[model samples]
Target chain A: MSDSDFSILGGPPSERNDESSGGNRTARDDRDTDADPTPELPPGDAATALHRARLYSLLALGLERPDGNGGLEMDDTTALVNAAAALDRTVEDAATAVDDHLTDTAERKKRWASLFGVEEGHTVSPYELTYLPGPLLTTVRQLADIRGFYHAFGIDVGEKMPYRGDHVCYQLEFLAHLCLRDARLRRAGDDEGVTIVVDARRTFLEAHLGRWFWRFAGEISAHDDGFFAAVADLLAALVEDEIAILDLDPEWVPDTSEVTEWNEGIFGAAGRSCGGCGADATGLEDLEGSPGNPRNPGSQTAQDGLDDR
Target chain B: MPQVHNWQLNREVEFPYEESRPERQWAAMFDLNKCIECQTCTLACKTTWTHEEGQEHMFWNNVETKPYGAHPIGWDKRTLEDMGTMEWDGDTYEGDTIFETEDVDWDDPENHPTEERINEDVAGFMPDIEDDWRYPNLGEDETAGEEMDLDVHFDEDTHPIWFFYLPRICNHCTYAGCAGGCPVQAIYKRPEDGVVLIDREECQAQMVCNETCPYKKAQYNPAETISQKCVGCYPKTEDGRAPQCFETCLGKIRLHGYINTPEEADDSDPMAEPTNPLDFLVHQKEVALPLYPQFGLEPNVYYIPPTTAPVDYLEQLFGPGVEDAFETYRAIGDGEEPALEGLLNLMGSTEWSITAFEVDDGEAVGYYEGDEVGRVPITEPQTERDRVDEVDGEEVYRLDIT
Candidate 1:
């Protein structure tokens, strides 16, 4: 961490030491007109692009901190809004790929359905279970929220924006209001792919598979030996790739496996620390870097040492 | 969207909103002074709302250590990624946002692979001491999944008792980032009571809210294909009742009540000043305290710091180490002498302490309680972050000035 990263929000730090690069007091001044000057990618490397996209996306979320007046620079804000719009196309494309791959191989599709526990029967669809209210309503409400965004900067989404059914595509169009996601949607609002895939997912989870899934998955894992675990690992890897391409953190993408882990840990907390711990645990005296543990990720050199005296 | 919070107490309105209409518009206050981190609230929520498959990893209610934050790895530290604070351009406020990213795959259960239990070699039995324990398996060897648990459960770390739990739930903020960030419009705040909720019907399981939220409170439900969080128990509060977590709370630290509009802050009612939702939560009512007011999300949960620790320790957490400053923070936390003095002067020079919380001017004032007399300017934000440092091998007391 650099001195630039220092800024107290609320409460005191958990530990304290003397590492003052530049001690400065700043009054709250809320306005983000300046633009980020970081260098862009040199050329076209999809993986690099993907990685940058991921980091930038994480940064976008971080910008929500109260320090900069609860807002972001106009450039960064537009970039993120645009990214959201573009991701919808990826969603549509992925859904389309899965649906298209399903048509030619009935046996494969059937096996895929059976393996994943898809009880809705074999079908070529994008699924609507992923959006909200209804497929059409997802676009409507999302658009409603973005309306404030447009009004803030005097941008327009044209007439097709309002009352549109394709939220993902419309999201791409909404990016046109800024500039980032504008290129992803082919600049149109016509797509039936994701709407279908998400719907089926909703149906299966809410009605059929939602119940006993945890226990079933658990029992299967315990009995898997290794083959099923390998297959599960492959599927997770594929999905992880998809998420990375979308420039998202694992947490950002909703995955049941991760959520389940969180649920168990949270439940076990016994509601401790809900009211805040009052102990002023002293910061252990500044220790130097450890050469003994090659595995230690936190061992920093003197740069890690902050002298308090 | 950039509206600042108002903390003045307003008395005109009543609390424990109505369910049918979701009309409580009430705020909760947590007395940090009384919190013991029993995590009763966390379990209370899990047993009631998120025991299902997909929600297994989510803690709709958690009380993590501040500076160090919950979920999404280092969320508090990540805030620096935005401004020049983290290694951006320079030392100047250039504005930033909790900018929205891709809409989360709200119902994408395939990507989430699970094992019977945690892999001992990966997440490990003791996480705190190991430091790199992968509770969520964030960063680990590719083959870590090869090892699975043969035991009945995982082991819990034993942190020191000095810690405070910031019992958390959905803030149901008036201007909620989760709701605003949802590409599917799945997360929405009830207009009736201002309790934020996930319209599971509208949510497709795209965890956009998960990314966009600075707090990362919006959780994924694996089995249901939806996201869920505290609706402030609007369903219960609307009916003049506290939510299950609050009702079942072993500590009983949560206070559910409504505040009049900030416009009426000057009126006899409480709940004014710090008009923004966050300031309202952190001060005055003295219920919950801001986990890290510096990171913008502007949470509505407030905490009343416990009195068990030294007055100096409490002073540092709030502001100012002077004698009067100590007295002031204590007074507001007392739940008797009106709003805390630190909360009042910190925000503005307003003498009206009721229904208000002051943050900025909470520096030192006079001598007492074995502390130095006279006031000193509150510590700078940079020093606050410096409070925590990783120990290296070598000589002790090296000042880090990167």
Candidate 2:
């Protein structure tokens, strides 16, 4: 195993030695419970792709709304630093800066809420639609396009995520998934699979994440200068590196945020209400004891045995 | 020509492909009596499936006021005009279908859609993307027949003025016209569920499908350089859930299920064993009729003809079943058909596709793949509140009481 790989997966300095001294279950489990014993790392380009993909996931996790006592985990921070060091010196410095400014979970949680949560009116919008130009109804096609990319690969946002398909975290995670798929395909010696996944990653970065991420980073830097600012700096650096590595020249979003809010009134009265009255037919459920409604008597008796039936 | 039986037309019709029915066909029925012209179904389908740039003109599910409204202006009028005069003899339609309007010999390999002859021989006109699709609501809420009079009170049997909302989606036809008209043969029907699809990789953008699809549903996506239409929400249907439009209907007008031919229709009492609700509504009771069945596609989506519409006008739209359908529907209101009434109540009650349904003890129970997912009372109970109530030693008047 490479020294950088050992650093990226940060465990006790003894975990590296444990590899040579048979397997250390405790240390490996602490990092990844599903870690394969003495796993062989993909060589060269594939290894770099895997590391980059992991960093993308780490960045996505860093940007999500943290729970009351949840912030960037210690191992993730360590991995971010070590992973950045292997990829770029500037990103490594940004990662070191993030480590230097690391605060307690509660403090970072507050910062996240202030920056991206609904409570503060989302001071720095983490949604891609907020960065795109044109009215929301018109520009929503971009959101659909992003979702289309995910769907093309048979990826869907799970119920647990519950985020809009265009949320930055989902976009980032999508890119990470593509890159990870590319690395696995490469390792399996499936040239065709590698080509397909790599092309998808390049296209996604060019179309979505590549266009607006810098604006997102700028918004973070303008609003805060502590842990989040450093993380944003790292995000910008990593994305820049990915662009250069992929040899891409993506069209950047306009510097000014022309955020479009979907106003109900502008579209007219019809848009005012939807998903209305989960009931059908003028609130028939509220109507009691009518002629054709013979089920009223049966309903009273049936309610008791609902579970038994 | 390969002649396939279209029960809707009560005749055999010409089709490009041989007769091959899927193991099961996806079907839906809409109760027109309850529709209020609300476009919730349109938006639901829009937000879910066709929100992209090229899809601006596309409404995979659209509602239009009958007689005067159409998504692509005059879509029905133009197709019907092109087909010339069509008349029904009892139940049999004596008119050329869209496939037969141009008199192309389907049996001849030279006249096949794959032979690049669709431009010359196919029926229906290709709609202008800019002009036709621009006015989805051109005739929305506009009534046909006589103008409104403040004191217009007609008898129970007849009304001078009437209009009803007609919600439309791809019928996912048994012999899809789009599949028949594709020059590259890119369009196909799935053998499992009869969901129609245009293979994007195989589509050469011949655009014949757009011209020949009489319903104007096989729309060309200029951005993708391909023809696109509703895929029947096969992904959801495969998992036994209703399509988005059917699930999101505010009026509970839609019931999604599967249907079989009259001979194969399941007549087993739903209370005794699983029975297809669509078969019961379509084949047994015959309360529902297909939209434009004379088009010869045998569209799977059926409708309960609007009770208030003029019988002659409705006969033109839903074929000769208008009067009979209305009679059967009226029987539900009279409490004569409790099972059917219960099934109507159970429509849109859940997101699951109801494969089987039963009226058990005055309650309508819907089942998906034999697992009960919906149950509703055939008759809803009512309560009347007193006009005056004492609250905290003060008399309170109830303005709204039921």
Candidate 3:
């Protein structure tokens, strides 16, 4: 909405307007899609307060992992020791080997190369968001929106990175880095600067990143897999928590049932993006989950279907 | 090879101070059978906690119908595939529990703190930066390009058939995904309560956790540099009242309290009678019933099997077979990190825990098993008229819309 919003989005002024329009579309769609944005709310005032109560209630229902093994092969403590040892070998000591591919690229090398195209060599990994799908590029635009919101609240992503990338996480990291950066300068006696930066941390998180976060995550979750949904869920919880810390009344953290109804009617739940799904997506036909069905012997998942029956 | 976040994966692993105290022990339970899909829990949560800025993506609490549940629809397909175990439901897909990974950049950077600390284990750029939630799952801007049609995204089977509201927030796991996923060790579990949170000063928003979490609970905050996340409203609960969602719940379905133990293990009490439903859900491993327990992150959230979710859903998503596969995987020992099975069991097979609801008094019921926790009771049995009334009007329980 402002000139700064364009800059934070990673583009020139002219491209900014186009992107802003597009971004607005994204926001609008988030509110207008098949998702029941207007989810019914509880019958009470201080609805947000009720929301806060439920959040803590759910957080309490936690689970545990087998120290390292289901312990079938070893006992719980033994599994923990073994797991710790394995972590020393494979993870803690290893370099970024994850359960899934480190990067989504079909060809890690090619992907890495594109990302590390800089003449100075690869500062950024090629497998990073630089290699993701085009739509993913919009992450930059969202970043800009976030930046703009921060700016509106007088918070800057600060100087964590030389340049903001399209990656949303990276951009947020930039903000976190700024927090530490400011803290260091402050400890070095840059008290004034530190104060400004710390203040930015609170405002930026509550105002920009916290607002419309569910809408953003919903977009990712609607079409993506558990990874996206999980990501959305985590983000939703995190932002809400932060908003509470900041003492900012985030509308998304609905307390009243009316607000929930309103929210569902506007954005759908589970961070599920309804912005782009076609209108009237009301039947199994609308959701072609059949192909991904384990029942569909023709699908890749068929062979792995277990005999739960 | 373990994809260790250059920033984190090694901070002086501080034992949560409060968890050591017996009073800090906390837990939860869910009554799937009692749930009518009213979504009051979800709505109450949103309005009370998530309705504000930057939190549009979060649902600290939500209730959905069984089978083809969730907004994204088919959540189980990927869980099954990721876990390497799922059952077919003829033309439809069924639930299949999967394992999740705990890594850096798991949540959105703005949601938690990244490791920008001067020296706490992170070694790059003078400090490590990290985030809590990962993935840009929020709104769009002009820059995201054109609407890439949902068709272009992935499959429609993303939705399952037998829906049940799996209202979720943070599990506050013994081993939190948000805390473990921090590349810079910016996130940490509160010493007193074991609630995982982002250290504002330490977070630099590197996004390592964003990509590392198996559950994808972490997310990205676009242009922000730091990550953020849920804090359990410790400030509020410190007084022992209740969480925001719990307070706002019109149905009074939710309860709030503390968990006293650091480990969610059996504590030599497989059939130990805990105090509340929270205790039941918190000690899931004690019951040998897990919700994608294969993640190995040691989550703290738990759910009872949904009595009405349909047995077929359980078989297809996570039956004993998948559980066996996961158990076997756990048996593989720790030497091999193995690939992350998003929904698979420890043995890299299907694993799931359904939401089960039962009642003690006419109104108070048990939400889950393994622990002596109580949940809200269902007033009436399932009936077409009842369902119609629920759909046409709001009720105490969450009845399926269909």
Candidate 4:
């Protein structure tokens, strides 16, 4: 895929300009202000493509609580609302909540902390690896595979981005990046390139995001009914629509219901309780204490003391 | 009822099944001293057989740190407490077998344990969806005694605290508790290899096999509504290959082979016909002992007791031979005794079943199907290492090892 395809931020083929100028041009000089307007894809394809791109961008930005520095300006909020309306009316209320004062930078940060847990026990993890079954601390393979997908397209998680490669925000951002690439490929009439990009996006969706999105969305919906809940609905809907668009075999994808059940067995009410206080514990924090949580000193101590003889 | 001589117990015990002995009983030995709890064996077994949807919590092979680790959470302690403190007079154990311990009669297939037959003192446990279900790492790395300081060396003869990994799998016992407990005779031991398996079609989800098996290896799959356990990787073994766990063991601590029963071997000299490595360890040199032999299950799986763990604890677990086993293991590991050295070498000789083996030139050469397959050295070959500058401002170091 071309570099422009993966760029979520709209830009020209800067690599081509760099090669022509021997990399001596200023950032502004590389701008394609006078470039010709590209032909659009077919109506159905163009609308689906645009909707997917906008949805991904909105979900990516929305999942990460707004940073006070600058994020999701008026135009972005309008775009998100318009995109949500275009996709389905069910998400319209949630779309409007995107611009609510309660979602302001500081308030959103607090909400983020409450929703996606701060350290260990209290929050729902946004990490895809956490939802899978296996021993914790051996999550390298899954994380590496996700990183490989990003690296294959010359994308890297910025040092400033506070999320791991498997985090929902980063995953959504990756999908948005792929959608943007798909749009560029289609516009350029590079059918082969479009096919390759679409296939990659479909694989990513079926394997990673689509596999776990519903369970994650369920968790969010369970906790909230406003902005995030709406975002969750939008996410689930978008994934389903994408699966249909790509003509991917639904049978090949893992059933999210089964995954939800398995996850609940590990992190739900019937699962292991806090060894110290006997309170219901979920996530790694409750099992292994989160730093500075006085309720749990360390789960290792409790485990050690569980001698029946 | 059938009676079989259990050499570990030094007495014949009653078995519920008839005298239908296999042509060659499958046996294995685990060297605790070499295991590092890497979970390679566990993962290998998991990915091979138990990756299905319902088998998520099942670990056919699990390595847990003693005295606080167990896959089913308190499997050993609960069973031990239920059986009560066994009487050991030196090397001889005077204890009731699983059949003799309770009031239930073994001869009658309908005579299974009711709620009343279970001792009230011992906590009744079922592998439920709650605390007991998903605790594979519940007590992992929780060693006995105080945590030693960083300055304390592990090589020291005596340490304040220590823990060792105990890798466990289905023992495929001669008198399996699951087989005896099954009222429908759903759980059976194959006459060919003596590998015990639960017949899915015959199993009615009575969970008697799950409750009766002291080791708790038989797991209930709610989705399938049948209990399952390790099949001893029979498909691989049938083709003269080692099981997945044994083949993938990173520590090379596992040895799998066929062993003759007490009746089949020459009683006057048990080591006379020693062929495979397990025969040398279990029957001849007597370096490995079955786990919890006092339970009178005649478990085919044997263990070379951990050298570092406390003697009293080891004795309680592996019976009176723990000290002797440890001594023999240490001697074999150090290559002090040639016979023991040969046995250790043969343990890692090949991936295929070694029918006959001999120690030659400090290497254990193994033969399968009347042809030599591989040889393993008593000690691994040392690698040569050197560092040199290859170009201006560039340096590279290379070491040759596999």
Winner by TM-score: 2
lDDT of 4 by residue, A1-309 (tens): 111112111112233234655432222453544443333332235465676788788778777756764345567778887887876655555566665633556666666667875633545668887666543323345677788899988899988876778998888888888778877777777766666667668778877887778778888888887666766777777777777766665323233322232434443654323332122334423332232233433323323333322
Q: Determine the iRMS, in angstroms, of model 2.
A: 22.5
Tens-digit lDDT string for candidate 2 (B255-289) = 99999998899998765655789999999899999
The C-alpha stretches of model 3 lying farther than 4 A from their native spots are A1-308, B1-25, B71-80, B83-161, B223-225, B250-252, B260-289, B310-312, B315-402
At residue B383, what lDDT does model 2 achieve?
Answer: 93
Q: What is residue B28's positional error in candidate 3, in angstroms?
A: 2.0
> Considering lDDT, where higher is better, how would the candidates rank from best to worst?
2, 4, 3, 1
Candidate 4 chain B, poorest ten consecutive residues by summed lDDT: B115-124
Write down the C-alpha DockQ for each prediction.
0.02, 0.04, 0.02, 0.02
True contact recovery of candidate 4: 0.00
Best by DockQ: 2
Per-residue lDDT for A162-186 in model 2, tens only?
A: 8899888898789889878877888
Expressed as tens digits, the lDDT of each residue in A1-309 for candidate 3 is 111111111111222347545531222343466443222321212223233222222211100011231101212223223322332232212111111223232333343233333544643331222332223322234444555655644546446333453334433443545444453554466555555554555555554555456555555455444322333454455456556555776434222112121123223352243332222233324232332234532133322221232
Residue-wise C-alpha lDDT for candidate 4, range B113-148, written one tens digit per residue: 333232211122455544455667555676665567
Docking class of 3: incorrect
Q: Could you tell me which 10 consecutive residues in candidate 1 chain B have the lowest summed lDDT?
A: B118-127
- Model 1 residue A28 CA deviation in Å: 44
For model 4, the chain A TM-score is 0.62
Clashes of 2: 7
